[model samples]
Target: MEIREIFAHNLRALRKTKGLSQEELAHEAGLDRTYISSLERQIYGASIDVVDRIAKGLAVEAADLLRCPEAEATK
Candidate 1:
């Protein structure tokens, strides 16, 4: 998968695992709910700062959100 796709997939999984809706995550991250949805959909690229904010909101390391499953298989 593309890096953006990986980010989107991981983001969705993490959000679900945390039992948080997009709106809740957005609120926690101090971002707009629509922006969160757009990120989850891979409709836009996220800056490093935004990624950090998302990771903080999810209580996880930023790198965790960037992990790509396909890249792991190539390892």
Candidate 2:
């Protein structure tokens, strides 16, 4: 999958795992709810700064958001 797809999938999974709604994650990330929805829906690509902000919001490493799902399955 593409990087954008990986990031989107990871973001959604992580957000759900943390019991956060899109609005909540957006708040935690200091971003707008629509922007968060756009990211999750793959309507926009996240820059490095945004990735860092999201990682911080999720309390995870930025790399975690970029990991390929198939690769993660083996670990």
Candidate 3:
């Protein structure tokens, strides 16, 4: 998979772990629901600022949004 796909996967996992729906997460992150959906689907790329906002909203470090923990194991 591409790096973007891996990021989307990690984001999805983290969101689920936090028990947040896409809409809820979008609202909390000050993003649009469609945009959030696109991000989760790897259809849209996120800027660093956007990632920071999402990480902050989810109470995670910014690296948590950009880094793939499982991918590290696979590598």
lDDT top scorer: 2
Steric overlap count per candidate = 0, 0, 0
- The residue-level lDDT of candidate 1 at 30 comes to 99
Off by over 4 Å in 3: 72-75
Cα shift from native, residue 9, model 3 (Å): 0.8
Residue 59 lDDT, candidate 1, scale 0-100: 97
Candidate 3 local lDDT, residue 75 = 97
Per-residue C-alpha lDDT of model 2 across residues 16-61, encoded as one tens digit per residue: 9999999999999999999988998999889999999999999999
lDDT of 3 by residue, 2-73 (tens): 767876887888999999998999999998988888988889778889888888778999887777677778
**TM-score of each candidate?**
0.91, 0.95, 0.86
The alpha-carbon deviation from the true structure for residue 26 of candidate 3, after best TM-score superposition, in angstroms, is: 0.7
Off by over 4 Å in 2: none
lDDT of each: 0.93, 0.94, 0.84
How does model 3 score by TM-score?
0.86
Worst 10 residues of 2 by lDDT: 66-75
Winner on TM-score between 1 and 2 is 2
lDDT score, candidate 1, position 43: 96
Clash-forming residue pairs, model 2: none
TM-score of 1: 0.91
Ranking by TM-score: 2, 1, 3
